[model samples]
Target: MLDTEAFRDRMATLPHDLSEYARVQTGPASWSAHPHAEELSAWALEDHVDPALVRTTALLVDISPTDVPHVAVPHADVAQLVSHREAFVVASINGEATLETMLDIVGLPSGELLAIICSLCARGIVALDRSHRLVTR
Candidate 1:
């Protein structure tokens, strides 16, 4: 038999926000996303993904099983045909490559790619290394 009374007691003791997702700024701008809000990640930026991240950021393997996880938009439920342009960015992040170098080498327009990176950052799959690389944390 299920213990409904016990379940109610336990639920009452827990904080309301226990499962609440944490809000994070997508960039210096007003964009935001809740990494833990849903089973699948979703990012909703205001105007666009920040460019400075592209200028000064490099991605490191965080939640990826390998140094490079398939460079998708963090597996979110959105539509934009954001292809795997950042694979080079992720593959080259040997803790030595810089953001500018990735952009130059990949040679793709930086907007969608940057958004994908920022989405990864927001989702906690990757983080910006202070030493100028992305990393798992």
Candidate 2:
């Protein structure tokens, strides 16, 4: 299982607006890049599981039971961020967002992001090191 605390902590380091967007959008049924989302969705649909339950289950993919307080993103900063894609990109690269998170941050769809990430990983622009963290060389 993915480490929820670590995941949330990493996400917390993103700019405030992005973090809030992530938190508000997060729930059991919210979309996930996790490999399990499709299978879980299919099962829920086929079995007629309560949509709420399905959503809750989906939220479990990245949520931790332990509450970690999040730092607020100032409105002014968020406003500034709206016009600064370069800043966001730099921050993401510095923060080491996973290929999936990086794609979301850059507003690319999953397929395209996956392709780019795969290509970069292959070329060693981004690589998983001994700690399983993606790093740029």
Candidate 3:
């Protein structure tokens, strides 16, 4: 398993508000930027997945069987279907959104919504909130 506590400690030091799409941490050694870094961070935190694991998983998404364990989000299909904007929007209101609100905002059929959310849940991108509402991580 990933060192979640250590990852959380590292994440706490980052700027809460970032202007870029991606930021990479090289374990106190170096940092790089990605086009989807911030979005990834938001998704990971909300879902309770370690942010470092998210980054590592994203990097290995295209490669089969690398040293690191695989993560389910950032998959090719999921990436094609969702954008950073969608992820950000989902993560922001996941705590408060009702099914009706989500239907209105996403403008998708009920079946589609269920399928998309199910896929997200499988990938650890979305989860149930304390109130049992669907929330994105």
Candidate 4:
């Protein structure tokens, strides 16, 4: 079941004015400076909320799912990750894959996978293309 209270609390913490953060490209298709990037990612790692729902909420809060960004690991070292699932997701990326393809390759529910991706993205470990870098997902 979805935890509405926790979800709302998380949402409340996210930045309302994303324009202030300014999308700065630290790596391939990454927006490292987004206000919600780090906070959201950290929440995903520790929060008890459903991963799939968190993924959906993340999209709604930052970018819409229809945007379907391409994702990739910017760095080679992902050994520091504590969660095996997160490490697996990082390993599964070869070059850049669509968010849909990543979901398939990682074999994790969308919520879990996306949360990991978001966390990596915040840490400059993964890059998510917000623009039309790859149209087909």
Residues 6-60 of candidate 4: C-alpha lDDT, one tens digit per residue: 8987774554866535554333444355768888778757869876566545644
| lDDT per residue as tens, model 1, 74-107 | 4353223323544444544544444555555566
Off by more than 4 A, model 2? 1-92, 130-137
How well does candidate 2 score on lDDT at residue 23? 67
Clashing pairs in 3: 21-37, 22-37, 43-137, 46-137, 47-137
Which of the numbered candidates is closest to the native, going by highest lDDT?
A: 4
Error of 4 at 87 (Å): 1.1
Give the whole-model CA lDDT for all candidates, comma-separated.
0.46, 0.45, 0.49, 0.61
User: In what order do the candidates fall by lDDT, top score first?
Assistant: 4, 3, 1, 2
Per-candidate clash tally:
1, 3, 5, 2
* Model 2 accuracy (lDDT, Cα): 0.45
What tens-digit string does per-residue lDDT give for candidate 2 at 1-137? 99998898867353445765766778555556667989877875696776545544443343321212121344345445333533343344533444445555668665544443333333323333224433459
TM-score between candidate 2 and the true structure: 0.27
List residue ranges in candidate 1 displaced over 4 A. Answer: 1-88, 132-137
Question: Which 10 consecutive positions of candidate 3 have the poorest summed lDDT?
Answer: 62-71
Residue 7 C-alpha lDDT in model 4: 90
